[model samples]
Target: MKLTVVGGGSTYTPELVDGFARLRDTLPVEELVLMDPAQDRLDLVGGLARRILARQDHPGRITTTTDLDQAVDGADAVLLQLRVGGQAAREQDETWPLECGCVGQETTGAGGLAKALRTVPVVLDIADRVRRTNPHAWIIDFTNPVGIVTRALLRAGHKAVGLCNVAIGLQRKFAGLLGVEPPEVHLDHVGLNHLTWETGVRLGGPEGEDVLPGLLTRHGDRIAADLRLPRALLDRLGVVPSYYLRYYYAHDEVVRELGTKPSRAAEVAAMERELLTLYADPSLDGKPALLAERGGAYYSEAAVDLAAALLGGGGTPYQVVNTYNRGTLPFLPDDAVIEVQAAVGAKGASPLPVPSVDPLYAGLMANVTAYEDLALEAALHGGRTRVFRALLSHPLIGQYEYAEALTDRLIAHNREHLAWA
Candidate 1:
């Protein structure tokens, strides 16, 4: 099988390369293409990728290129992980939203909306090229604002599935807590991308008995601490919300904390510099340990599983992915893309039925669903009013004044990225 990574120069590529090397049997790639516009980073990352493969005795060939069409032509699958604007733009996304007293984040609130606007068009163009060059190829998106980007790809009628590390990260965490293998812990992870909750933790399979209550009883404080939430809230809610939800559950506090500390983008920029320096070393053949601090834990496993299943590579039948709701959640529109446990295969990913959602979570999901509708609208058709409306619709920035300020800030900071502006 052939695979193409569009943002092959990213610091995260080595983690993915390490996974591909270790899980070669699951997704036996014969040709792995690293396609990036940044040739310098691509050369460094590509060299490390080759060394990783050689170390593992994997025979797959590594190719690097800046030509999108050439890289994707006749490929079995294409993974989208590109940042439309680099970390410099991300720093703006992470800081400008703070001017409005909203949590500065890359994938939520005003910042996330900005990322969507900048990312969707570029991804759509690439998807168009992939479809033209290889219609049968599957598109696995690992980009931020995944819900919006995946929705754009699917709406455009591309063969696509969205991938996120959140579910896999949670599964690994839970398995460690429960003293089981990661695959043995099945999470009923549901909701839109980033905004999701682990409503159930089953063993063996999806139908296996739910052990969530027991988990909470024994490890509630630990889980709550890990999530940076209060144990009382976790106990009361009866579910574990993704860490991303901390922006919602504690909006003002998070905003205050963000204001005090440096932007996450700043920290990541420093991290990437160090990682790239490490990649430049000829002796460094394996993925650096510090890459763990860069996040996206278990990303390789998730990507390999999803890609193998999609391309008839024969892997796990059930995995967590972001796909159409298709009534998986009665509350969400069928077209709404949600992250949940799904039955994946050569046909595609189909979300599995979720247990009934509590009103507490349902209400928030519905609210965010509405905001996402507007966010997509703003992303597709750029305008100040559309931007303001999307910001106003967000639960975190519902007030008119905050929305107005955020909209202006978003347009001003993203003027170069926003064609309409």
Candidate 2:
């Protein structure tokens, strides 16, 4: 089957290419298209992609282009990984929120809203184009602020599913610690994208034995260390929170730490420069080891598994994905997008039933869902008021004064991207 990657020029592309090469038996991609506006970066990444596939003796053909329509036309599945404003815009997103004494993350808080506003429109336009060219194609979104972007695509009636590496990354980690194969570990992963928790770690299947307690007893410190959270917190909560939760569980501390370090975007920019220089080497046929430090670990495996299942190919029956809640969480609106374990297939993902959620986690999920709803409104129908309201609704930035100031800073830093501004 033919597959397309919209942001194929990203430094992350080589890692994806490596997965496509290694997992050919699962996805069997025949024509892989990497589309990017940055022609120079596209050439470097595209060349490496071709070499990776050839080195593995895979028969898939790799191509690169700047034309969005050409790249998506007739593809079986199209993956969205584009950054609307590049790393420079991300730098702005990661830094300006710090001025308000808040978290400066790209996927949450005020900065996340800014990213959502900038990303949703562009992703919708691409989805529209993809639908026009190939209505049957599935849109697999790997973009940041995935919940908002995927919600926009689904609301606009596009065939789409949102993918994140967090679940897979955690699964791999848990498997290594448990001394079991990756597929043998199943996570009772639930909550919204980025903001999720592993309520249970089951083995064999969704109904298999829950080894979470044993895992905690034996490897709590290691897991807590990896998450940068306190082992006592994990013991008290009795659930493994995603690393993203740190921004919430330790907001002030995170903000203080963020203020001290260079923005993640800046570090990534430097890494990308070095990665590009490495990609320029003709002899480099594999994804560089340095790419692992660039984040999105196991992204390729997640992408491959999701795409394969969506296309009626080989993949795990149950996997974690972001899709319409459809009452998986009794408290969340059915239309709200949630990340959870689901049975994926050609028909799409249906979230598996979840046990009753504690008020602590459910309350936060409900709060963020409301914020996301407002964020989507601002993204779809731009206005200063909408921007302010979304920020004001966020649990991380609930104060009106902070919201108002952040709203102005967001628009100011992103005026060129916001059409209404």
User: What range of 10 consecutive residues in model 2 has the weakest lDDT sum?
Assistant: 105-114
Where does the lowest 10-residue lDDT sum fall in candidate 1?
A: 351-360
TM-score of each: 0.99, 0.99
Per-residue error at 414 for model 2, in Å? 0.3
lDDT (Cα, tens digit) per residue for candidate 2, span 176-286: 999999999999999999999999999999999999999999999999998899999999999999999999999999999999989999999999999999999999999
C-alpha lDDT values of all predictions:
0.92, 0.96
Candidate 2 deviant stretches above 4 angstroms: none
Q: Quote the lDDT for 99 in model 1.
A: 84
Cα RMSD to the true fold for all candidates? 0.8, 0.6
